[model samples]
Target: MALIILMLALQFYGVPHSSMFTFIFSGVSFEEILSRQIHLPILWVSYLIIPNFIILDAQRILSKTHLIQLRGFQYSHLQFELISLMGTLFITIIYVLFSFTWIIALMKMTHAQIFSFAGLKEMSSYFLFFLMILIGLICLVLIQATLNLFNSVLGIILPFSWIIFTSFTVWKFNPLNGLMLLRYSSYNTIQTFIFCFIIIIVLTTTFLTVVRKKDFI
Candidate 1:
């Protein structure tokens, strides 16, 4: 209900739809959709609720299966590292693909049509888009840190530092360019952001649960 209200308000404010972010397939353009303006409910259905469902399920699996927990070390365990590494790798690979394709999309949107090789410098105008990747990374660290803080204040100090790092990145960077997306395609970076965000959350939770099984004593 709250999400629906927020979505309606955003539409009233002309937020411009941002549902184009999908990780299922690569190299596909969103040109086929017939709806000029889609219902806001579609945004929640395609963008928010479904993906979070996956995260919730992933957490359940990790907790029950003990995928990340293992017997080793005093400060850290093999399971924790493995789980965190999974989160890191998931974020890294998605970031790489998003960074590459998003830049390509941005270049195609902002600058005139040019071969991929031609618009390298002008494309760099949006360094902040890349900064968005940190949004996912920092969010993962923050969740773990906050959890650790509840258990052991000292454990979360590093993750707390990430709050500062994320702030710094977001402070100087604002690349939403909401209008450009509607003009070019039926989507925006928010799709990419939310998709990646859920993945990071799953991995982070998995890592924390696995690692904490050992160090949580």
Candidate 2:
């Protein structure tokens, strides 16, 4: 509900939709602006809200179970991670669908050509971008889970700090030159995919190791 209101306010205030993409790229052309308008909502939701939700939920679950001992702790940890992944995926899909629908309505209002080949290409790229971010979010959540298990304070601080640092880097340095976790969001599709794949593998392995060694109580 708040997300919807924010979106409406942005639209009502005539915020340049492409302005969001400027954080990722140095300069965006007119055609790129159109493409961005079709996809920025998904990026907004994934970057701004999803990670916090996952981390908070992990914290809530941990708080409740800290004093309880399950017969199969390892299995329970795996299930928790799996459930988080599924929930994130489901939310991402629903948000993306809503974003697409909103974009279509805006296009119709402006009488933009909706069935054009270029539009279709942009939509395809949006889905690719969505997939990359989805994978990255999963990796992030797993890392958060591991941190939460090891040290709850660090778990909370690190993810929030990473996000703040990423935003600062995006504003202060050239995104192409800066090394940040979210730098991949502005990279080529293949590069983003490879980076996400590597991060997921490393984070998942580290999470499993940490969960196995750490005492839950």
Candidate 3:
């Protein structure tokens, strides 16, 4: 809750008043918002940090309870992974929904023009873009957690490094590049979504397999 508020405050402060509506309604992708390309270093960093908050909290819960839950409670590895994945999904959904809701509210409050038909139509596109980003984040989180299960240091480094690396590069077919796929990539929304879906499924399956095999001491 506090972190969401902090993100709101940062957006309100870092973004110029005259450009707030443009920033909201304009073609600002969530990736750009998270990257240093925005020139608002603090805001971009804060955006990236939000996912780490989720990662750290999820890790804490899993680490603290995995042993007891598996041994004492007689939970199967598949059962435990399912519970953890469900928890992650729940938190991700809530976080993304709340973040976007507040952003939309802010846009509406500041730019009354959004109530118009055209603005509302444009808003739907943003929703789809956000959904893509949400799925990408989920994949990244799961991949990170899976790595962390094996080695803590590598877990944080690889996933985050990819995010930072992608932010700096401009790849047209980058499935993770939500708006870029529409703007520059040959792949359309459906194609990008298919790729993302595949990635998520692969990552989830791999994570579960690892959990089953890993001797969590």
Candidate 4:
């Protein structure tokens, strides 16, 4: 099984291309990975080592918490715990990796200028990303409050409401301007900001609502 998994991972990571080291990502098949001219070393590290590190770290955290195995909880299961733990790890890797990736990219691109903003116009890209994550948290809280009070289908209503509210806010304030905060967080052009948003939301929600409240007996 380990050998098979390794083979599969080899397929997924593709291979490193040049000394520049820019083109490598997850894939499920050789054909899918073929689109990027990734070379051999990057392929091995990204596909096998990285995922193993993520899963192992997740497992360690879960072992420490042991919340799901607590006898008194009304909603606790090993399967659910495993999934949640994996989600936690995956989201962590995504945000941190993207953040560092962009930071380095910015450093390299701008020659390590030590980013600082002096404009009275709009927030810097890093600051904007921070604001965006904070706003998402605040909106999530407002959604939960609204759902609790008004008894709406929060799973559906919350996202729609967030979109509408964010749209209104964007149209009204126009703080971000034309500068995309997302650009700093991705190496590949195909990597979208939506993933970062999802990762941030998941991480924030889980930390605020779940892990903090869970009893680890």
Task: List TM-scores for all candidates, in order.
Answer: 0.33, 0.56, 0.70, 0.27
Best by TM-score: 3
Cα lDDT of model 3 by residue, 1-217, tens digit: 4455445445665333332323332333445745645432333334444675666546645756676757677876667667877777777777768766766665555543332331224666666666765786677677666776677677667766756654555555666555332132334466668877888888878887777776452
Off by over 4 Å in 3: 1-45, 64-66, 112-121, 179-188, 215-217
Considering TM-score, where higher is better, how would the candidates rank from best to worst?
Answer: 3, 2, 1, 4
lDDT of 2 by residue, 1-217 (tens): 3364346445544433322222322222234444553223234433444555544655447546752554345446555555555565566556545544555565455444443321223666556544654554555565566676667677656655554444333343322112222333344445656765786688768866665555353
Using lDDT as the yardstick, the better of models 1 and 2 is: 2
- The residue pairs found clashing in candidate 1 are 68-79
| Per-residue accuracy of model 4 over 66-146 as CA lDDT, tens digit each | 754654455444444535544644554564455435543543443333333222122354454444433333333333332
For model 4, the stretches where C-alpha displacement exceeds 4 angstroms are 1-93, 110-114, 118-157, 170-217
**Where's the lowest-lDDT run of ten residues in candidate 3?**
112-121
Tell me the tens digit of each residue's lDDT in model 1 across 54-145.
23233334444663343323324444555644564464446445544653454344442323221113345233334443454445443443
Best by lDDT: 3
For residue 166, model 2's alpha carbon misses the true position, in angstroms, by 2.8
Give the residue spans of candidate 1 off by over 4 A: 1-54, 57-60, 67-69, 72-82, 85-89, 92-96, 99-121, 133-216
Order the numbered candidates by lDDT, best leading.
3, 2, 1, 4
Clashes of each: 1, 0, 0, 4
